[model samples]
Target: MSKYVLIGSKGCGSVVIELAMLKAGAEFELEEIPYLEPGPDRDRLLELNPLGQVPTLIMPDGDVMTESAAIILHLADAFPDAKLAPATSDRQRPAFLRWLIYLVSEIYPTSTFSDDPARWQLPKDAQDGYKRTVDQYRKTLWGHVEDVADTPCFLGNDFSAIDLYIAVMRNWRPGRKEFSQSFPKLTEIADNIANDPMFSGVLKRNFDT
Candidate 1:
């Protein structure tokens, strides 16, 4: 089988794609890009994605795909039997798309900024305060999702890619303990995903727990 080539770094956004591909039982190879440092891996990654982002996927057909959400969605569509997402005709499709995009647009960027305050051009002394503010706002966003979330899963009984997202993201910012306390419902969803046989190994490997 022709393998999909996944370009990503450890403990980064690529964890989500890695879990999604594993769930789909897709044949793939992971190419670790040296994060932020210049070398052959960085050069190759830059050639594929100028943004220098992780989760850049090279499909079996040799086409390059970027963005975590898009790659996971494509994987779901390609491996229908895996049921990584709701079918387009399914009623839950709207909610699936809604929250997936919400996470990408709203919550993900805060991590981007907080992880590297220099990206926003903040001074060294102000960087800590900036990250705190971003982390607090992220908690608020989590609260909103938690309020609307269903037990055992983000969209209810069925497991979808959104749960994969929650599983990885909840581990970031203000720490998992704070996340669990601030948003119990979402924590349940993340916990469930973490425990699932399909995802457990990858989660452990990524988080190094």
Candidate 2:
């Protein structure tokens, strides 16, 4: 049996990877870290991941993996029975890769900036403006996602890791209420996943809502 260890923070994008592992029925140990400042936990995390980011997975063979999208995609491939992703030969595979990459590359960076605007080294007077710009961009990005979303889910009928990722990311920035109102289709997909028993526990555990 392959051992899996996930180091992550609550309310962070890492929640999606954690949920994916659970839904996959993959046995894994979770280590939570504090984001407030550098401390013992963060120090320990750096030893495994030089960047010290959460959702770092210590694989059974002792290799380390980072980035939420990469980690979940790996899980989906490793545990085919979990059905977290479409098979490479599946017609939806290309679209799946497209949206997944879009979320990580486009939307995910905004969330990071929104969470820690100071990281950008903007002048004090410019911080709020930078955040506002990022917020508007995030909203527009989500609208694009809504435009192409399939009914009942992002990939239609089936629920995959992408939906799980969207569900968690929706809770950030504009938050659930505003996010739902702005992007109804994407919100519907998120709502479905939130209500689903497989994901409810992880949601409550991370977001407490």
Candidate 3:
């Protein structure tokens, strides 16, 4: 069996994990799941993860892991040579963790809510408002990151999982064009990743860009 198995769908946030694995040169199998349509594949995914979420990683020992940020961090630490994250002793480690968690905790939820406003349980008539609110919040979160982003990437010149996360999220609501116009710095980071041979192929495979 491969060292790891990643269950994911195209264009999902899971693509960040996929790109991280590719950069790390990890030997892993990709299991594509139809996350939107209910079928055998989705059922199989649910069997492994009750949440039926993509980006579920199955270790060789049969342990299952979920969450895009956690999986990316795990891969970074597991394969130190890849330098996908800052070392624990590095001064930038704190900043790295901070932005990564902020993206996962603060910004990620906005995409979830915007994508499925009904999940918030707001009145049917209020669904559009919910989406708009989430969209505005996403822009606000990215704006804050832009203001503090001093380097070409999120954590200096080095390309880390944080950049991959930002690049993937940039494709979400307020899409690439609008997002680029609003936060050129952040867009530059994503563009750099999107243009890199190491990552561009994976990005294109997942997003068809």
Candidate 4:
């Protein structure tokens, strides 16, 4: 079986990629390295990813891969029966790739900036500014995706890895319904993914574990 050593926190979006693997019914071993102790994970994932990011995939042949996008796309390729991705000849392939990359390159980065605004060092008076910068970017990011998601899903009628990544952001800001309200279609996609029976156990076991 392929061995997947995920080096991230429970709250990290990489976990959604892992969840997609499980949902695809792929056979793989699981390992977790908490983000709180990133050094050990960084050192450990060197063979898999020089950058030492989580959601790294170690193939059965010992070839390693890193980055959430690469990992999930690989999984989709490996599990053809799951059909998490569009076919190569499909007309939607181009648009799908566009949205998929945008989620990682654009939306994911914005959420990261806001998720932990306090990480940046600043004077007490400047802390609010850092936080405000995060808020501004978050809204900008939300508006971006929501505007483009004119259909049921980000990829326009297909539920791809993009939805999975966005759903994890629901808990990022926490304690406010408006966090998701701004992005109506994006939020609906998140809720659909989270509320699905296929993901019921994952959503339930996620926070509890």
lDDT of 1 by residue, 1-209 (tens): 38999988877899999888888899999887665898888888888999988989998888999999898788888999878889989999999899899999999988887898887788999999988898989988888888889978887888888988999998888888899888888888898888888789888988865
- Evaluate candidate 3 by giving its C-alpha RMSD to the native, one decimal: 1.4
Residue-level lDDT tens digits of model 3 in 65-126: 99987887888888998888899898888988898899899998777767877776778999
- Report the C-alpha displacement of residue 109, candidate 4, in angstroms: 1.8
Which TM-score value belongs to model 4? 0.84
Residue 200, candidate 3: alpha-carbon lDDT: 92
Error of 4 at 209 (Å): 12
Best of the two (3, 4) by TM-score: 3
Off by over 4 Å in 4: 1-3, 38-42, 46-48, 114-120, 174-176, 207-209
For model 3, the stretches where C-alpha displacement exceeds 4 angstroms are none
> Model 4, range 1-209, lDDT digits (tens) per residue?
44555555566765786678777887666676664464766566665566555666677777777777777778788886666777788787777778778777876676566555567656677777776776777777777778878556777777777777767766665323776667778778877877787775665565541
Per-residue error at 146 for model 1, in Å?
A: 0.4
Overall lDDT per candidate, in order of appearance: 0.88, 0.86, 0.86, 0.69
Q: Tally clashing residue pairs in candidate 4.
A: 0
Top candidate by lDDT = 1
lDDT for model 1, please: 0.88
- Per-structure clash totals for the candidates: 0, 0, 0, 0
Worst 10 residues of 1 by lDDT: 31-40
What's model 2's TM-score? 0.95
